[model samples]
Target: MSPAQPSAELLEAAQRPFPDAKAMPPSVYTSTAFLAREIETIFSKEWMCVGRSSSLAQPGDYLTYELAGQPVMVLRDQAGALRAFSNVCLHRMSTLIEGTGNKRAIVCPYHAWTYGLDGRLRGAPFMTATTGFCKDDYVLPSIRCEEWLGWIYITLDRERPSVSTTLAPVADMVSDYGMENYVECFRETHVWDTNWKVLAENFMESYHLPVCHADTVGGHSKLSEMECPPGLAAFNYHWITKEASLPIGNAHPSNTRLEGRWRKTTALLALYPSHLITLTPGYFWYLSLHPKGTGQVAMIFGGGLSPEFMADPRADEYVATLKTLLDDVNVEDRGCTEKVFRGLNAATARAGHLSYLERPIYDFMHYLADRTTGFDRSFALAAE
Candidate 1:
């Protein structure tokens, strides 16, 4: 049978052209069936950033993530190569690991089935007695994993292009930041009470900044000063150039390649499917999204000073102050998005017209439309 589809209103919104476009319909945010389609069609096929490779610099370091319906874990093998594998054990389907940590081997807690960091089966305490059983035949399923600019990405679909290929446009724009050298110093994981789309849309435009972030980062740059250009196949970015009034918002110590107003510029990006980042000359921050369901999203946030800032004596003070500022920003965003989630369910709910400043949002909707419906312009899906 053909898979279910998003609502007609939503499919229409997804295909709407920019400037004349409206926000996505409420059903898109609240429909469980549409969420299932997105999970299988979009999230399952995208090469999404999970975390920093530096966390796995040593052999045996591992971290866990739930991608779509799969329980996945990425680890460093004895040769220091990164590998991603199903975290489920072959024996009785038990989850092999609980959380992030260092381990010499993955041992299933239920039956003690052991596997190497490379995902090869090494042992099964009682499986030898089973007729025709062999450790070599029971390797943990593996997925495609790659690293780019310090971030580790994994795609359940092996046919997906290299993450670098998908991110090339963004890579060019962010190359001057020396991003691969910036180590992760602060990290946070949380499940927000909102749709993943709500959080992602919140970051796609600066329209709400003046009202939503008045006390923090709102007024630093006016909406007119921001630039939202078209994005490539896999991602989109907007430019924000402004001087800071916050303690850690000053020009970065390195002051290397950025010239003119760009010295104080920042790039906020949305990597289709669900990766968001804010890259600045002095520091960087990211929010990696995973939808738990229609109403919840798993958010992974990480930030640190730039490589140049890390070498300065004020690095400690700057990072500490930046962390606080980010925390405040998070608090405000959480409240705003959660309320928006509830508002999406209102009987009076309907999509509003898009603002000119929300160009990235329009691009994101196009990316979603193309992937979910297999057409760049619009999808006219019929009932199966």
Candidate 2:
């Protein structure tokens, strides 16, 4: 079947509660059954960002990742074409690639069976003469892969809708930003000891900026300065905050280009279910949140923008300031989320409420609800 596209009516339904004032039930964050359903229905079927295209800059370059518990390998073939496949060996079901690296061909470590970059079986020792064995019938299963704004994305269900059709609004947003030319500067991994949903909820709203990130990020950007751009696409908010103070030392003068008091921070272009692309003043950061279980999540953050900003005299200073801000926010957020986890764990707490300012969080929940239950006839019906 062809991929599903967001219809104008569906989009309109998604935007119905535009400036939403309602709060979401706490179960949305703490339920294990909900997480399982999300893994099965949402993550498996959606277009999720895995890594940047630059990671596979040359032929034979590859990266191994797991999404919704399914191991996947993203690689460029000998012909330099990008592709994605289940990272499992067809013969013994062993993982083909352990981690990210460059390889001419993938050889299952359990057995010597080898597969080419295109995921076609290149050789299977001792299997050719086996009774009822057909090499032609055994090739690594392929997954749907797509690229956008230098990022690589994949979907587990081949029968699901195409990535482009599912994310047309996101494409339009990227085009508006001239993202093709935006360069990456730095990418790092962050692991949070809480449910992935908790982290996502924290990121979806700006209500905590004033109290939680006051030291570094709050000093720079005001809570009221944030803006939520319209559309159903995930992670589509924008904020322009002012720098508390100028550079303290002469460590790097190149960053003076961004010496102004105000700093623009986009919530990050989220493709849905997992990938998050955050664009700062001089750099872009992409994060893929892989859920391990009810309370554990592997957050892979990687990506770097161009080095032109670094070449400037104060570039290092600017980068340092931004890094400090992010570090402070992460620390603060992790602490609060950990506390939230404990709160949700309490048997006494039955339900929690979302604030009116946290509309983005509700939007996300509504989207998940629509996708999982299919009870909201408005979305699917509107698309008609």
TM-score of every prediction relative to native: 0.94, 0.81
Clashes of 1: 0
Per-residue error (Å), model 2, residue 52: 1.1
Off by over 4 Å in 2: 1-23, 174-176, 185-190, 233-236, 241-268, 310-328, 350-353, 375-384
Q: Across residues 1-384, which tens digit of lDDT does each residue of candidate 2 receive?
A: 101222222233344453433433445556666677778888877777777787788999988878778899999998878999999999989988866789998999998899888888888998867999877788888878988767778888778776667776766654534454554445566677887877776766778777777775556556666675433744445444443343321112333333343233344554567666665545665567877776777887654433445566766666676666566667888898888877777768553345655656656665665666554635532543
Mind giving the per-residue lDDT tens digits that candidate 1 earns over 1-384? 123435565667865566578888787788887887888788998887888898888999999988888999999999989999999988799888967889999998998888988898888886667899978898889989999999999999988889888788778877877778876878778999999999999988889999889888886768877888866667778988777665344456456666677677788989887889888877888999999888899999989877778788877887888898899999999999999999998999978899988888877777777766665542322210
Error of 1 at 349 (Å): 0.4
lDDT of each: 0.83, 0.65
Candidate number of the best TM-score:
1
